[model samples]
Target: MTYGHAHAEHYDLVFRSRGKDWPAESARIAALVRDRAPAAATLLDVGCGTGAHLVTFAKTFAAVAGVEPAEAMREIAADRIGAGQVHPGDMRAFDLGRTFDAVTCLGFAIAYMPDTAALDAAVARMAAHLSPGGVLVVEPWWGPEEFIDGYVGGHLVREDGLVISRVTHSVRRDGATHMRIHFVVADADGIRTFHEDETNTLFTDAQYRAAFERAGLAVTRVHDRDAHPGYLVGVKG
Candidate 1:
């Protein structure tokens, strides 16, 4: 789903206020890439939202770019990076006509794929853009067993001159997590509310492994903590 204009406008502020560690996450990803390809110099971020990771990645990689499909989100990302650096594309079918030393699909963006076929297609396309011996890192959504049905979560943030409240409820339906998020924003201008509904596909670990293996990449799952589903690291060649 395309993020609304207001949601995109406040995306960074809300997440930052919520204490999402963008720099640390980018550092971890860069370290993961260097572990496999010591000389990795270029990187591509698929589904890069607001280019928060890109800001830090730019400091580590000599060249960095991003692919985002949502126009609202893409515009914000482009503004953060550069208009020439952020391209308009989707994960399942985007061809930049160049390969990078590292490719990343984070924030559980892979879960946006509706089915296994799409997942395979997405992985294959990402792998196709990897240079020989390059690394692909994907942070996946919760697996079927880990997802809690009818879960409710909320966050409130007051930053600068704005107050933002976000509430979310999720349910597992037909092997997918259906979530409805409501955001309330109040500023000097006025108070407004927005709703975002998203469905994330629930793929098993075996399914993710198969997608990576079928793409001709050696893959491993790295679960860093107990609360979150971990990353899938794949290497080309």
Candidate 2:
């Protein structure tokens, strides 16, 4: 994963680069958890890149932990919260030897699983780490039929005497998003460019539910009137 070293340095700056209201969006996500698991006091964010979700979750939950596969991202997350609060492990298989009241797999992280079997493993692992009645919230990538092929996007950011620009070209193929992302960073040290290639699997709503059910969760797929991609909500039984 390119995020392990290079991209991790720029990961925290991305949402800001894209003009996303971090506080607002995190708050909305927190609200969603409160709605589904009103009594949830602990949370674990799988693929907790840069600890963005955990930062907000900390405000609402009594205890918070994050499982991030990328060492660099996990390191920053440790700095954000505490070293002991973050774990270095893959979402497909991780064990903290404890259960959480709520588990969050956001940022379409599940899309990186590559296939349905991998999704099953990840979902089952997450569900196994949930207390009875605990809730799992997953934000997934677009389904095969829903993806818009040849999609292009870009972002620019200026921070701490550095300027960064990123451009991405993506296309849907064979139930995956084949994406090429290029980044240019300029600072006092001069300028440099790097690229990362990613293939995020496009799993449909039914497929998502199937994984949750196989994990012994009661699942429901929800859609809103807004443009925001919806989520799958599952409750451990």
TM-score of predicted model 2?
A: 0.94
Which model scores highest in TM-score? 1
Cα RMSD for candidates in order: 1.1, 1.6
| Separate clash counts for every candidate | 0, 0
Question: What is candidate 2's CA lDDT for residue 6?
Answer: 72
Q: Each prediction's Cα lDDT score?
A: 0.93, 0.86
TM-score of each: 0.98, 0.94
Off by over 4 Å in 2: 224-227
- Encode model 2's per-residue lDDT on 1-237: one tens digit a residue: 548477888877876667655566567666677787889899999999889778888988999999999888889999999999999898888999999999989888999998899999999999999999998988888888878899999888888998999999998878899999999989999999999998999898888999999999999876744315777889887
Which residue pairs clash in candidate 2? none
